[model samples]
Target chain A: MNDSLRVVLAMIELELRRLRNDRTEVFTRAVQPVLWLVVFGTVFSQLHAIPTSGIPYVDYITPGVMLQSVLFVAVLYGLTLVWERDTGILKKLLVAPAPRYATVIGRSMSSGVRAIIQVVIIIPVALLLGVSFIPNPAYFVAALAILFVISGGFAALSIIVASLLKTRERFMGIGQALILPLFFASNALYPIASMPRAIQIVAVFNPLTYAVDAVRGLMITGNLALLPLDVAVIALFDILMFAVASLSFRKIIE
Target chain B: MTFAIDARGLEKVYKGNVAALAGVDLDVKAGDIFALLGPNGAGKTTLMRILTTQFKPTSGEAHIFDLDVVRDGAEVRKVIGYVPQETSVWSDINGYENLLIYAKIYGLPSRSRKDVIHDMLESMGLRAPAEHLVKTYSGGMVRKLEIACAMLIRPKILFLDEPTLGLDPAARIAVWEKLVSFKEEFGTTVFFSTHYMDEANAYSDEVAIINTGRMVTSGTADELKHSLRGELIKFSLSDHRVDEHTLGRIRGLEPVKSVVVTDSTLNVTVEDAETALPCVMDALRSEGIPVERITTTKPTLEDVFLWYAGTTRAPGAASSIGRVEGKAGGTRRE
Candidate 1:
């Protein structure tokens, strides 16, 4: 194979190996979303006064919860960069023959895979919880595409933050603070129309809102029509974040 | 023949206005063990970072085998292996697994990776610990593992930054032996940075002494010692008062370069000690100034360090020699 392809494959292998060794992290990543789906979905389902998009509360929240899980887990990707810097592993890689951009892409891809795995685990649990949806093959593909884009965009944002922050503690602290605000402001917990005017405005601009709306539309109605716009927004965000991330990463490595 | 590494006017300043490296010029010929000796914060790590392409120079240029570190870093990285100061291998993974991951990252041939990994493990004396988690290994073992990872690719030029720090005396010797064998067998150009004067003198074919972000001097160990230009005479005085009249008489002796008086001793820096000692002793005896003990020793690398950098001990360590003039000229003993 060519050099770039080899590097990409190697990076994937490395990530898989690391994931296997940290089985606890993988298990937690899978379990956390299910807990939110079961506990929050049931408790909030009883509150019948809350409005939804012609669906039950559990069903509406399932997609949002899944998207939230993927977004949160993806932050670990950037946090790992901070750990790598402290350990001098990043410096070691910077000296290697691989193109710097390829390294960034490889890491983003790995984070995307982890995000997909979490989504897969959540889907069956969502079904078991009576959160039913139409299974359109086209919608399935679109949902997967949305997951990839959102995960990649979040991972890129993580890398950019990790590169700018000097310490791992600072990175984690700032990452956690940013995550809560982004989730609350997005339509992760409720529909944009039902939210207050100020929060609705915030949700319109939140990238995760696009991801959740797109996935919710697919899982509930199997509608692929609006999937295009959702996918486009997520893709645009990913490209913008990746560009800024790669530039900042290059500066850090340099 | 091309040099393994060449750098000109390489400089780096951190975000806080700390000048880590300031206009360093260096050259290392192929197939030689070159050591850069400096105290901590003397910009050794910064220079290494730039040379490895991990940190960009504020100005100037560096080339590894004709590949520009800035412009052709990707290509430059393929040929060089860097063992960073920190032990960075994944602590949760086994030694063999760590090597496997690194080898794969370097795109080593899949078919040969197993054999290569086994060889590196055995060669680094890590065969028994090959299957053990790195977290279980001792500090010295972890360091050995780092070296093994760097060796997996058989890099043409190897950079080791403070490889033996924190190692016991026996482990330090073992590491040195391994480095020597690696260099001799593979003809790899080895560049290492160290703060230990004795370690540098013992292991380096050529040593570069750096202080305050600049190269103070560079030469073979023997050449540095020879450049000190006089025998060092240290005498233990029975009384602090070896009268000024007697000190004047000792200074008047033939071949005596200079005399320095301290609280409890007299030290003479001389051109020819055999010719000056008897006359100096005769003057002391005539004055009834008792000398409890006397000794003469040849100049050492530490003396050369003291002569050039103006301090007796390494820069970050403790020592009593006040500042030595930072002059760029060679001075001969009288």
Candidate 2:
């Protein structure tokens, strides 16, 4: 295989190995979304006055829960960067002949794959909780693509933050603080129309809103019409974020 | 012979305040073991970091095998293997897995990786612990694994920073032996830094001494020792006070170059101790001053460091031996 492909494959294998060994990470990532889907969905379902569509609360929250999991688990990309810096592995990689871009790409790909695994694990549990997957195979594929793109974008953003920050604790603090605010401001929990006028405008610009809308459309409405635009926007954001991250990382290494 | 690595007027200032390195120059020849000796914070690690392309120089240039570290970092990295002072391995992984991962990062061909991993592990004396998690290994074992990882690439230039810092005596010796064997077998240019003067003198073909972010001197161990003009002799005096006339008399001796009096001892720097010692004793005896003990010792790298760096004896400062000397070995320079 060519060098770039080999690096990507190696990184993927490494991540998978760690995931297998650290069952806690797998369980933690898998459990958070499942709880949100079951407990929150049921509790919120009783409050029909809260204004989700005639669609059951489990169905409404399933997409949001999956997207949140992707966001949360993808933060590991930044944490792993911190870990590598502390351990000196980042220096070792910095001195390698492999292209610098490949380092960022390989890491983002690993995070994206992990996010997909969590999404897959949540799917069955979502079904048992009375949430239905769209019958169309194309819609399922589109949903998967959206998940990868969104996760890749988030992971890239995490890398940029981690590279610019000096310490792991600082990065985690900034990352966690940013995540909750972004999630609350977006249309993840409710439709944009139900939100206030100012928040509706912000939700329109929120990348997560598009991701949640795109995935929810595929998994519930079986609509793939917006799939192209949604995927394109996410891809563009991923590229831009990754470029920024790579530049910052290059500065750090240099 | 072409220099494997050449650095000229290298300067690195972190945060625009801390001067980690200041206009240092180095020429490491191909296929030689060069040791950079210094105390902590002497900029040894910073220089290595810059050479390995982990950090950029604030000014000046470094070239590895004719390739610029900045403009040609990719090419430079292809030929350099750096084992940093810290243990960079993933503690969560097994030794075998760590080596394999590093091999992949070096872009080793898939067919060669398995054999390379096995060979590196065996060479580093980590074959028995290949299956064990790195966190379970001792400090010495972790260091061995790092060396194995760095060697997987079979680099042309190997930079080891404090390679034996925390290792026991036997482990340190084993590491030195492996380094020697590797250098002899592959002709790799090895540049390592150490605080151990004896180890540096014994293992390195040449040593560079750095102090306070500047290069003090660099040369073979024998050349450095021979460059000193006199033997250092000390005499314990019963009284701190010695008459100026008596001190002048000692200075007028045939081979005594200078006499320095401290609180409880008399220090004499002399060219020929055999000729100077009798003259010194005769003067002290005639003056009726009691000499408790007299000792003469060869000039060590530590003495050379003190003469050039103007530093006093301090804890952890003793290891700053092998201080680099400019031509003429002068005490002060602009």
Candidate 3:
């Protein structure tokens, strides 16, 4: 109906069309998280390396792997922006009559769809490894919502990075540098209680920490107590990122 | 009457103080095809970007159909369609899908969107390949598709940057034919930039030559060529007796404006080739020099460009005159 809403929907349609044409990325991207669940989950579960409150190691890390998959897909979304800018696609977009911020919002939202594809792929692999998710459908729906919100925030951050670093080479170096630190510093692979005091502080600031906490609490722990705090932090991250990303979006064309 | 586009003292200074457009002033009439001709890095693209509202000029003002491009960018964008120099169509998507996205972006009515895209594809002769991916199409087809996308909205003005670059001659002709028909059909002002002299000379109603970000001159192609105000007489000497004394005697003749010698060949610009050719011949023959071949021809756009822009040809410029080594004993009209 409205221009911004229309742009977002059009972008989603573009992603769907692209996916329909080639589905290899959705399947190939599933491989890394599957490996984490099968190889790393099995090795750690036998040794009982970290306490999981009696939860199976494979099940405990299933949500983390899903968030990891989503994070990787969303954060790398800016690469598309850089490539588009170099190829002159961005010039056409910027010259259109639509609001400038809508382009950023629309493109970032498409990354959420890409994240959803990764989630669907990981769910099957998790089940294959005998990982159990809470049998509640509402909580399952809530987990997907949380994942989408997390993805929108990370995708916006990726666009901001793209606006700053215009070259693909520079963006790739910085994107890889940002992704691993965000994953390792967060509680995705381990509990923050086992991390050093400095890393604990860093993990508190990392949005991925709150994302994993929400998904892990929703589908695995079924403990909805900290759910409100996790959701608030993630929503706040999303809003802040979208604002900054919208402000800097035009710089990619410059 | 309001011009279709007007720019005054537009200046864009990039980072490190690199001036892409120093100070350009331009105006285009409505429903006319205007060509901005220049060599590479001559600020043609920069000026187009500013006019299209993709980049803000560091200083000065531009208006599209009297709407300020910077202050009212949305309004300007509504009336202008831009085809950038690079290939903007998605290689991964079909031609139809590419048009669909652009149609949505331009806010075309949802109900008519399909019909509009189909008609444009057909008009551009891309209807047969509408379902095929753009990557499979030839370079000319890809260009036509981009033009179709820009024209989908039927904007009042269409801006293209190097629209036919890297296309073969037949493809270039195809692209121009579509543009000409589009202009005639919609009365849309077609503003495009190109370094090719022939395209400018042949297609444009008005042509502006830019050199290093400044507007060198602007007029119809005929006006530019006729501004040289003389005929060129080209002749070569078979005998080696012709020397500076002979060239000076020829320059001293009443009708000769300038004389330039390159190796065995001599180029003489004269008030009238009819009167000057025999005098040149007699001067050479008096020095016991035998003329190999002599011909008189009107000055072409390339000759005009060289006289005004510089003696050297711009890189990648198609030449009507073979490479100019140097001018000698010559007076080039200032």
lDDT string for model 2 (B160-244, tens) is 9999998899889888888898899999889999877778878889888888888887788766654654665788997758889
Give the Å error, residue B257, model 2. 4.0
Tens digits of lDDT, candidate 1, A1-254: 37656666676677776666667776787877788889988888898756785788888888888888888888877667877776767777766667776677667767877778788888889889988877788777778778866887898888888877857668768878768878888877777778889988988889998898898888775555766788788888987987788788975564
lDDT of 1 by residue, B71-180 (tens): 98778888899989987688877888889878877878889999999999899999998888888998888888888888888888999999888888888888888888
| Winner by TM-score | 3
Tens-place lDDT per residue, model 3, B1-334, is 7699999999999889999888999999999999988878888888999999987999999999999999999899899989999999888889999999989888899999999999999999999999998889999999999999999889999999999999999999999999999889889899999877889888999988787888877788887765554677878677554578888998898887677777777888775678778878888888888888987877567765665566465332213322332121122221
CAPRI category for model 3: medium
What TM-score do all the candidates reach, one by one?
0.85, 0.87, 0.89
lDDT value, residue A2 of candidate 1: 72
Query: In candidate 2, which residue ranges exceed 4 Å CA deviation?
Result: A50-54, A135-142, A251-254, B233-294, B305-310, B313-328, B331-334
What's the distance in Å from true for residue B216, model 2?
1.6
TM-score of chain A of each: 0.90, 0.92, 0.96
- C-alpha displacement of B240 in model 1, angstroms? 14
RMSD per prediction, one decimal?
4.3, 4.3, 4.3
| lDDT agreement with native, every candidate | 0.79, 0.80, 0.85
Q: How does chain A of candidate 3 score by TM-score against the true chain A?
A: 0.96
1 against 2, candidate with superior TM-score: 2
